[model samples]
Target: MAYTSEENYNPEDYLKDTLNKLDIGFVKVSNDDIILNHNLTFNKIFGYNHEKDLFGTKNLDYWLNSEERNKFREVLFKNGIVKKYITPAKKLDGEMIFLQITFKLNKNSKGEIISSEGIFIDVSERIKTEQKLKESEEKYRVFMETAKLEDLKASLYEKDLLARIFMDNISGFVVLLRPSTREIIAMNNYAKDMGGIPGLTCYSTIGQSENPCPWCLSPKLWKTGEAQHLVVDALDVTWDTYWNPISDNLYLHYGFDVTDQAKREKNLKELNQIKSQLLRRASHELKTPLVSIKGFTDLLLKLKTEEFQSKSLPIVQEIKDGCSRLELLVNDIILASKLESSQIILSKSLENVSELIFSAVKVLKGFSHARKQKILFDLHEEMFTMLDKDRIQEVLTNIISNAIKYTPKNGTIKLKSKTSKGYFVIMIEDNGIGFTSEEEKNIFTQFGKIERYGQGFDVVSEGSGLGLYIAKKILTKHKGAFG
Candidate 1:
């Protein structure tokens, strides 16, 4: 009833209550082997009626065989503890029963064995299950050892098959070299097929005086611990060679001719760069002459302001119009160069989309006026977003300028900005052309445009074929949405 122990505590009532209510077995005795305690588990486990029936009147060994009693005496003398062990008991009805009992040998103040206390469990089923588990574990251990040996045999067979095929049928020169001494050690059938001279090394076959050529992949193998792949133009054989270290001493080298592929790729890249450069150069150069013509035509308009003659104004406007076309050619080239050189960095800012468009149109007011193209902005003033102001302006300018240059006079170039389907949409509409579906798809691909068509003026000025490509790259970097 009370859980704490005071200095003046008593325990006779507490012990009786616990023994009567709990499922435990215990016994107490004096130095002369007289029973003092017994619990319910003892009665239920061995078919005893009451503690008095098996107490001081009987010897404790009456429940154990002579051999087991001797074992208990010897173990108690040594360890003072006896684990769960089987014992035989004789019941009053003349029936025999078996018990799994554990015992603790207790000593008195004289340090002599007095009586014993113990907690015993009925583990007949548990012991049987444990024995079965022990047997199963041993069998599984044997099975695992056998499976491992079979796996090793299968792995070795696979390696043997690969080695045979590699040696006999592999293409090109597969030579093994000793890096330390720079000597030829082994060669596959392909190596022999290419040049079967004995005592000749990879350096000799490739016409290199040095053992490790400048493009040799041996250094990569040493650094990364993996096969190194690359193409090289050897003095004697132009091929794509893959190098690997088969072991610390032996290097495996193999390759085939790639001269035609190399030549085509190199020439194509150079041609593309040249064309882009022309677009940039043409745009920069034409700016000066166009400025001169537009400036003079404006001077003429200002002089005739008082009595503006419509007929003469139209002729003056025609000259200004020609200058505007030249300016567009220049703008396209400059935009293309920025895209080609990887110099296009889109800067992000929190600003109104409408404001950005208006400012760009203001900057290009003269060009738009000369072409008589109407610039209309369709954006809600309250709508704002985070974007690179200058970059978005440039994109808008490119689309609108192109429309102004290609569309007929008095045509409308509408600039619309709003959100659609979770994206901040910016659309430039012109009757000119919306980049046909096919062109739209490939427009952002670099060298992709050159794969279609750069540099220089009013006659046939085209882009370096990298503006849309570069714009695409920039938008991709910014994670901007594009349809």
Candidate 2:
């Protein structure tokens, strides 16, 4: 076991030991194609029990194709070496496998060919993997090229293959049917779980009916040759379904269960109705008390008593202002509720558009005067339109008052009227603290108040935030638009 250099220093034995330990097969072949020597790995790679079983065997006999072996030798001799040349070869039992051989010719000092030494690696698995990948690519190419409905119908094998590929990957119930015969052709797992089976009538399997369901869209689909969509309730489930015409006879039906969604929608509707009713009731309750308080405050202000005028007049006036603001808030809430429920009917009449604009300006003149703002009107004379005078005046009041309130002291508000394309257009422009882009989106939304910080201007910014909302709704009812 322990040998010094002088005792066992054989170079041939050292080389064979080194070659046998390598994982790759090592082979030396003579110029006449006979294998001169091979290692243990070579024996294993060629399914031989020992190197003796392969010694002196013709290397060309191992190649599955003799022509390939001839070509490999021709290339090796011409180039004096060949690296990583892949060729099919057979094992001892005649099983074919691919090999990657790297070999080079060994030459004597006179430059004459002597022998060739090479390593062999089994590359059969790699080749098989590449072949499978190529086959998969071809299958995908065919799937994409024949994806049309007409093409799918032309070949039954392609139709079934594509349908299985398409249906298995989606998360919903899907079924293919013959609409004319009412026969089910295929169904996905989801449909199968619901008792769907091919070759059965769709009405019997999916609809679970002895006869065609009255809501079946096949008749309509056949007539129009168009896809139809419906939300149907069946088997205690709600489905949002689409029946698409694949051909004159075939139909592809697909949908998802919407039972929970339908229930949530019903609940939301009920909650909205309750909210509207509560708002209307609370607003009416607040309006009654506000009207009584305003009536009493006015009666107290009218008294000419010296004690009341000197001591209580300012306080009573404050109470009246508070009452007025409360009344406006309550009225806005009531109007918003009505608008949401679509309960408002306009009483329209023929009226002068200029006169209506003037009436709104006159109502807000005192407030603008107190802030030292000017209202300029450029009205067209004899401009008449069939509109609800009271409702239009309300809209004008909301816009003009907002201008007066938001504009700084000593600012100008211009009202211009024109007749264009059968519309009596009124434009209200003011130099006010304009809304930012973000704030403008919420301007006509209920309770979407644009909060303002004091900027050293006499501006009344407090509001119920429903004036624009109600105005927009009224304009919409009048078949007009607001921006």
Candidate 3:
């Protein structure tokens, strides 16, 4: 059982040499707590350079206190062995590290404990890593809890701000009421201005009643969970009221004041009635005088009195012309009013389209002669359809007269008639003083005028401005398309 090493050897020495060659540290401590033998790794683990450097100088008890050493001995004696026994120990340099050791009891042949042997493994790095991981998890948990509380607080603040903004900026009166007692719980400024108050019944405040009004809708809303609506008249104003249930026993009451709109509509109706009466009376008062003036002028022109004819012919003609213009103006105003009121009923019948255009041309030819303008007619595919002959003639006369009035002395007015797509189309075009695009848009609108001087007249002349308006309405009644 002995091995020769320079003539002084034993099995224990050979075992110690073999243990030192391996990575693990080995220790043998005798009874009485004296260090017997240890490997070089054991010395290095405790910050010593060599195995001989840690002999009996410091026993295992030196690294641990008496209490922990006794606990280690008790466990070893009870279990007969200790595996992975982790304990805190001090190094030779006075620094602390965690260690794991497995212990086995070394006994003699008589069963008397002699010494203790164990394996030592450094676990300081592993312990430090685990401590750091635990600390990091604690920090993260605290941060998440704090962030959650802050977010909840911010959300509540945002909701409160939005509710206040809505209540203050709303246009009409608004109130929140408790359905059972009809108590006003919340209200906006407009509601307060209308005598609403918290803890007051709506029937008492708004309806001036000792009890709940019969028209109060909160009871119905509580039963059906649906909104109710009504109209109320108070303080000379009309209110459109609505009741909406927001919660189990809470209802929203809102109303709009419509007094001003109603008054405006009533005033417009009265004004229209007065306008119709005035036009009717003016038509009668003006037409009679115009007819007599034209009649006397015609009678004087036909007289055989040579003295009167030579001296007063031009004067009579001037008076007759003035009467004719006045008559035209009155007629246009009356016709435009009738068209607007839908009073002009058409008696549509078959008519000669060509004859209508020719008659209009013949009447306007004298005006064209005075202006030295030529009227050219291009009747293409003349056909008859259902039309009011008088109205059609009036439309034609207005269009041709407008052309003569606008055209220069030598400008030619071209009147064309054609049938296209089952409708008769008439186009009256003149080259002199044509309207701009902007003017053309409102040309057929009543009293819509573009400021411009005449092409050949000494001064600018804008006629009644209703000529095209009346013509357009006539075409509209006949369901005829025009531009």
TM-score for all predictions? 0.37, 0.56, 0.46
Best by lDDT: 2
lDDT of 2 by residue, 1-483 (tens): 233775575444654564565456888999999999888988888888863557788998889989999999998886666778999999989999999898878876445789999887777765764565345435545665666554334455655565566565444677877766777777667778877777787778765776775236556675786888888877788877778776676777777666765764574465456567678877887889889999988887777535584667788889999999889899999989998888988898889979888988899889999999989979897788788988889999999999998898999999998877898888989999887775676688776566564456567878888999999999999898874
* Per-residue accuracy of model 3 over 1-483 as CA lDDT, tens digit each: 345564674434555565565445778787767778788878877877783556685465446566777888888875456778888888877888888888877765444688888887776765664565345335434643654422222343543332344454445676767777787766667777777666688778864675765336445676787888877776567766778776666666776675654554464455455455466557767999899999988787778336575667778788888989888888888888888778899998988888888988898778888888888878864578889999999998988888887777778888887777888788888876776765676678766544454234532255777888899999999998575
| TM-score for candidate 1, residues paired by index | 0.37
Better of 1 and 2 by lDDT: 2
Ranking by TM-score: 2, 3, 1
Query: What's model 1's overall lDDT?
Result: 0.59
Off by over 4 Å in 2: 1-150, 169-171, 175-254, 309-311, 378-383, 418-422, 455-458
lDDT of 1 by residue, 151-243 (tens): 222343543333343444443555655556455555556555555333455556544557565435467675665788887666455677767
Per-candidate Cα RMSD to the true structure, in Å, reads 39.0, 31.9, 48.0
| Candidate 3 similarity to native, TM-score | 0.46
Q: Which should have the higher TM-score, number 1 or number 3? A: 3
Q: Best-fitting candidate, measured by TM-score?
A: 2
lDDT of each: 0.59, 0.77, 0.70
Off by over 4 Å in 3: 1-168, 172-259, 352-355, 369-380, 417-424, 436-442, 445-462
